[model samples]
Each structure stands twice: as structure tokens, then as C-alpha cells.
Target chain A: MEIPYTISTRPDTGLWNAKIGIWLFLASEVMLFGGLFSAYIFLRIDAAPGTWPHGLLNVPVGTMNTAILIMSSVTVVLAWAALKMRRYRAYWWYMLVTILCGVIFLTVKLAYEWPQKFEHFGAYIKPEALWKYEKYLGNQRRAEKGLEPRIEITGHLHSENAKEYEVALDPVNAEPDSPAMDRPHFFPLPVTDKIATIEKEDVERATMFLPTHSAYFASYFTITGLHGLHVLGGVLVFTYMWLPVSKKLYQRNPEHLANRVEVSGLFWHFVDLIWIFVFPLFYLL
Target chain B: MSLKAFHIVFIIFSTLLALGTGAWCVWVDLVEGAPIYLAGAIASFAAAIVLIVYGVWFYRKMKRLRIIT
Candidate 1:
């Protein structure tokens, strides 16, 4: 049996069936994202001042991804408009650009941004050894430039697991290009400059910040990961729409193809819309 | 009123609500010295503004063409 309203508007709603269906799906999607956003708010509010991580994400990279997604949204709309005007070639070109943008956005996110977070480890130093560690970093910086070491404080690195080991206060190969080195002083030693072998009892806790490290990370992974999945889904759908099957449909009924593009375009817009919020909330202020 | 016109109006109203809520949250965050909700709120406001402008433009174009009358 032929489905009604696939190419024309229904009498009651005055919208094609798929258009109504997409809107309903998008409404549910909004609610899903809304609840997660609420959870993010709650976590941020409950976090203690100075405990919430800031300036951890690379802002420039995130801004690039945001621009990419926004541009893709434009292409999506153009693709749909081209289809409506019966410009099949233009429609395909726009759709291909949209898909490419999605692919690039995901690549930057997973390849560059996420790995930086994973490679970073944070160690909680004991109050007594904290000052010594600062001095060690200073000495190490001078030594790296061929200058004489100033002062060395040797101590055992204490991890949160209660494991203690006598280790040098020297910069280890653990973290290269550590962001913490630029800051005055902070927890989770970005790098160790020089080895100062000291007693094992002087250290506090050492921990690596994985996704399980803090509430902030947990929410970050959850929200961004979900968004990534959505991007992937959009790319796949657009690719399928660009396939010969859709072309055959277009030949049979151009309006049906146009409606398909419109429905997909609506979804693509929503994906971009979510990223607009995600970019600022995750990367910027 | 026509269903199409009603849909457009509903979207406009929703956009306005998003803009208002986003602005309010941002103001609160500024006063409170960086609340978690502020970032999302600001983003939502920005996105809402873009969407509102686009929607209004599309509405006008449709009206001019008698597509949504």
C-alpha cells in the first residue's frame, strides 16, 4: 500500500508526514539534551570554588570546530533549498560539503582535543613537599637552558593509593609540553624537572585525571561524546541520501527527494544548534 | 489561523523564551563570578538569536511568495 502524505501535506497538520515525524523526534532530542544540561548546571553549582577546573581545554581548537559546524549548517540549508529548486547537481555539492565538514569536526575533536586530556596526569602533592617541588621546577627550567641548578628538594612521590616511592624531583619524560609549567604553581605536576631522591614518607597523593577523575570530566565526556555520535549519524544519513537510491527516487518523484532533504536538513540544523551550546559550555566560559 | 502560520508563530515565541532565559542566566553568572549555568545559557542565547533571525527571514520570504499564507 502506498503511504499518504509522503510528497504532499496532510489535511489536518498541513505538513508532510516526515516533516511532522522529524519535528517530533527533534523535540525528544531537545529534552534529552536539556536534562544533561541541567545535570551540568547542578554539578557546577555544587562544586567547590577553586576546585572546578578552568582553562583546561584548548579554546582555539574548540572555536575552529564551532566554526566548522556552523558552516555545515549553512551547507545543509543550501542543499535542501537546491533540492526544492530542482537543482540536483547543486544539491549534491552542498550535501557533500556538509558531510565533509562533519567529518573534519569529528576528526579534530577525537584526534587532537581528547588525546591531550588523556595524556595529562595530575598528582596531589603533600603540603610540606609542595614548596620544594616549586623550587625544583625553577631549578630545572634554568638547567634546561644550560644554567646551574638553584636548589634541589628531594622527596618521595606520594600517590592517593597510599603507595610511596623515593623519586627524583627532576623533570621526567612523563608530560612534555605541560601547560602547568607556565602557571605560577598548581596541583597535578605537569612535569618533573629534576630528580631529588628523598624519603618516601614526604609525598601525599598522585593521581591521573581520567574521565573518572572528577565530576567535570564525567559531564564533559558524556555531553561531548553524545554530540559526536550525533555528528556521525548526520554524516551517515547525508551520505545515504547522496547515494543512487535517492537518485532513483528523485527520478520517480523529485518532491519525495526534496522532502527527504528537508527532513535531514532539519536534523542537521539541530545538531549544529546543540554544538553552539556545547562549545561555550565545554571549552569557553 | 492557518496551521503553517501558527507553527511559525510558535517557533518565534520559543526563540524569544530561549533568548530571555539565556540573558537572565548570563547576568546571574556575571554577578555570581562564573556559575556553571552561565556558559550554556550564553551559548543558548547566541544560537537562539541566530535561529530567530533566520526564522523571521524565512517567514517573510514565504509570506511574500504566498507559500505560508
Candidate 2:
């Protein structure tokens, strides 16, 4: 079947074949994210509904990132528009703005959020400090639910058998009355009762002996860590492309530079779009 | 919007919807511990379908317009 518009051939012009190839590649990228999304769906289903809100994230921070990316998207589109008009100076300016936005986004991510999470990674902080943070989060969640916030208390002990036997954290298994299917058996706790009263100092020993109590912390790190890596990768790629444009290397070969920016823009957009999904999943939801 | 535009918007909107609903499922699972994963899966599947359709349509449109060689 013949396409309606015949391909244009101009010397050093951005070719249709290249554009098509890029689109095809982008489709595959969609599929790549599609797979991550599918895994997320399955895992989400496995989780008990309406119950997994980990309380450490700040929604406003994520929203700010979203706005930054959206604005960058606009700048790049203007850059492309300027290129179409062969307005090289405008192209450089808009593209530079886009690149600057990307840098700012990464800086905020690393400077603020990443360090905070790293501090909670149980690496440098004392056990008491870690416990305090966790309790603080739990209290924050309670407050959000309209309950008067009380001091976060860590009294729940990890079941000894919890290590040998894995409990299904999925809601299906969480049903108090569900037939114990694949239920991880836990060694009887030294402390009696489902809710154990724990002091800040004892929380470390208690949590180490039993880890599932801190599953939220694990999930928090995993999800945000994945996002941070993506931003880092984007920064490297954008920086490489950014230099050539900054020097007006593109003025000599507008189409080539345009093609490079187009490809990079596609990638940058994908990264931002993925974050759109990540923001709510990790922070708001 | 033209058919092509419609498809583009649909794909974008559906993707967003699926993500939103998926987050809701996560929230619900973490809180009420309800059986909402099935619903979330369905929504995401639908979104993926929309995206696939949009991809094919967009590719074809670009080809017709000679935007892609």
C-alpha cells in the first residue's frame, strides 16, 4: 500500500526513514514501560487494597517535579518549532531552557529526596533514630486519617518464624479468616499479642529479628530508587546532546541537530511520563 | 479532533487513567485491604490496548503524511 505523502529528500535534511525508525523505537519503549506497568498491576492485585499507604513521601514535592517536566516539554516543543522556522538562535535558547529544566529536576531529586531516603536506609543512623522515623511515619498516616496523632510507638515484634516461613503480604492472605494458604509460619514472639509495645532502643533488635514489619520502608526505597536512577540516566544523555547545541554545532547541520534533539526529546518525554505514573503510585496514592 | 488526534488523546488519557486507577488499587490494598487488584488489572489492560492502537495509527498516519519514510 502506498502512503499518501511521498518521502522528501533534501540534502542533509531530516529523512522520513529516520523519523519512522524513531517512532518504531518509541513504540517499543512504550512496550517496555508497558511491561513494568503490567508487573505493577499484578503486584498491586496481590497487595491488600486500600491498605499500603507508606507515609514518608511528600506529595507537593512530586507535584513540583511534574510541573518542571511539563514546562520542559513546552520548551522543547518551542525549540522544535524554532528549528522548523530555521530560527537557529531561538532554537538554541529554547533547547537550552529545556536542558536547564532537566538539570534542575535532577538536582532537586538528589539533593533533597534521595538523601532523606538514604538516611533512612539504616546505614548511618542509629537504631533508635530509625525507629523514631518509622514511628513518625505511622503517626503521620494516622493523623491523615483524621485520628489524633499520638507518638509513634514501635511495639510490634517480628515473628521469629517469620524468617523461616514467609507470610503472604497480599490482601488475599491477609484476610484474618482466610484459610492459611502458603501462610508463612512465624516463631512465637517473646512478646505476646499482635501489637507488641516496643521502646525506641528495643526497636532495632525487634526489627532486625523480624523484618516484614518494615516492608513499607523496603518498598519506599525500591520504588523511589528506581525513579532516581532513571532521572540520572536522563541527565547523562541530555548533557551530551546539550553541549553540541550550546556550541551551535547544529547551525551547520540543522536537520542533524534537530534529529538528535528529536530523539532526545522522545526519551526525555518518556522519562517524564513514567514519573507521572510514579508520582501518584509512590507519593500520592 | 481528527481521527488521528482522537487516537493520540485516547492513548494518552487511557494511560493516565490506568496509572491513576492502579495507584488507587495500591492505596486501597494498603489501607482497606480490599480485593481491588482485579479491577486495576482490567483498567491497565485496557490502557495498554489503547496505547497499542494509538501506536499503530500514529505510525500509519506519519507514513501517509510522508513524515516517516
Candidate 3:
């Protein structure tokens, strides 16, 4: 049976069936991401003062991913335009580039960003015991002598029990609250390796910079992980359409293929829009 | 909506996002002490300019084909 309005607008809605359906799907997606974004804000405000992490994420890489997603949106539009003009080969190449953008974004997120976080570790130093580890931590207090202290040591760690942890410092001066970290890296500081073996009484908490590390990290992983999945989903859909569906459908009904591409393109644009907000929220502000 | 109309809307929305993100990047660079955000700011503004150019060209191209209103 023929699909009604597959290639034509519905009289009442002035949109094709798939277009309306995709909009409705996108509306639900708005709610989903909206809730997650709200949660991020709530968690961020609820964090202890000056304890929330900033600059822990690679700003340049995040920007690169944002640019990749934006580029993908452009390619998706170009592909749709190509389809409209009956330039099937142009459509094919544009769609492939769109898929590659999604792939590259996911690779940077998974292989580089997530892995770096997992390998890194941090722990809060017990305020009372701060002076005891002065040789290693150097008593560089993050608080302004009145506020609750926010001293965290970051490195690769090995912890066999809740009582103690052994950490070889990551070598990069990752002290977020330290004014020194603000300086751009020009040459490696000629400092010898420092390791800390802390007993439970002197340790407030310790963790790899995973989701469990803090509220900020938990929200970060959840939102970005979901967005990454959306990118992967778009890549799969576009790949399938490019290889099998578009080839067969164009020969039969190029108009239907165009509508399909436009529908997918609409979804692609929405994905890019969400990242525009997500990038500034998590990575910047 | 027609594909042509939606195309215009999409380009406009993307340009707005780039412009907004560019401003945000500037704020982040100045206030947040991250000089790297300047690069993000430059990229976003460039994207906004590119989108505007592309939108104008695409509109004219579509008009030439009598495909858009």
C-alpha cells in the first residue's frame, strides 16, 4: 500500500507525515534533555562552595567536537539539497562526510576524553591533617583562610582499602584552585616525582575522576553520554540510508527519498542545537 | 512546511546559535581565565558568518530554480 503524504504535505498540518512525526519526536527529546540540563544546574549550585570542578574538561577538544557537530549539520543540509536537485552522487558524498563527523566526535569523546578522566584520580585532603602532608601537598590551602578548605590532589591512584591510597601525581599541575594551573604550559616544570600514601584518618575521600567522583562529574557523564549516543544513532541511520535505502528508493521515487533525507536532516539539526547549549554549559560555564 | 522554507529556518537557527555561542565563548575567555576559549570564540563567529553567506547563496540558488517562495 502507498504511504500517504510520504512525499507531500498534509493539508491540515502543512507538513508531511514524517516531518510531523519527527517534530513530535524532537519535542519529546527537548523534554528529555531539558530535564537533564536542569539537573546539571541544580547539582552545580548544590555543590559545596569552591568545591565544584571547572577546567577539568579540555576546552579545545570540546570546541572541536562542537565544530564537528555543526559541520555535520551543514553536510546534512547539503545532502538534502543535493537530493532535491537530483544530484545523487553529491548527496552520497555529503552524507558520508556527515557520518564521518559523527564518528570523529564520538572518537574524541570516548577514546580521548573519557579515557583521560578514568585514568586520572583525585582526593580531598582532611583539613585537620593538612599540615601533616606538607612535604607532599605543601599546605597550599585553597580556602581564603576562612571558608571551608577545598584541597584536592589529582594523579593516578591505587587503593586497596578505604583506609589508604597510593598515588603517583599525574605530573601535569592539575590543581584547579591553584593560581599556578592558570598559566599555559610552555615547558615541563623540573620537579621530581611525588607520591602520596595517605591513611584513612587523613583522607576525606578519593576517587578516579569518574561519574562517582562528584555530582558535577555524574551529570557530565550522563548528559554527554546520551548526546554521544544520539550522534551514533544518526551515523547509523545516515549510513543505512546512504548505502541501501537511498540507492533503491531514488530509482523508484526520488521524491520519497528526498523527504526521508529532509526528515533525517531535521533530526540532525536538533542534535546540533542541543550541543550548542551543552558545550557552553558543561565545558565553559 | 516545504523543504525550502525549512531550509531557511534551519540556516537562521544555526546562525543564531553560532552567534550566541561566540559571545559565550568571549565571556568565558575573559572571565573564566581560559585563553583557549578565544579560539572557540573565533570559530563560532566564523561559523555564523559562513552560515549567513551560505544562507544568502542558497536562497538565491533556490529562487533561480523557482523552488522557493
Q: Can you list each candidate's DockQ? A: 0.07, 0.07, 0.38
* Candidate 1 chain A weakest ten by summed lDDT: A179-188
lDDT of 1 by residue, B14-65 (tens): 4664575466557646654445546757776886787678777867765675
Each model's C-alpha lDDT?
Answer: 0.67, 0.51, 0.78
Give per-residue CA lDDT, model 3, range A152-263, as digits (tens): 7767775546677777764433343355644333222332256667776787887889999989999999999998889888898899889966799999999898888888
Cα error, candidate 1, residue A189 (Å): 14
Candidate 1 runs further than 4 Å off:
A126-207, B1-69
For model 1, how does the per-residue alpha-carbon lDDT over A1-285 read when each residue is reduced to its tens digit?
999999878999988899899889999999999999999989999976435665467654775687688668767766776777778899889999999999999999899878767755444445566445554445445447564332222223433234344443423222222433332221123445444433345545333445675678889989999999999999999999988888898889988988887787787777777876776676655
TM-score of 3: 0.85
Task: Candidate 2: list runs displaced more than 4 Å.
Answer: A1-17, A48-51, A121-223, A244-249, B1-69
Docking quality band of candidate 1, CAPRI definitions: incorrect
Q: State the weakest 10-residue window (summed lDDT) of model 3 chain A.
A: A183-192
Q: Using DockQ as the measure, which candidate wins?
A: 3
Model 1 CA lDDT for position B20: 58
Model 2 chain B worst lDDT run, 10 consecutive residues: B1-10
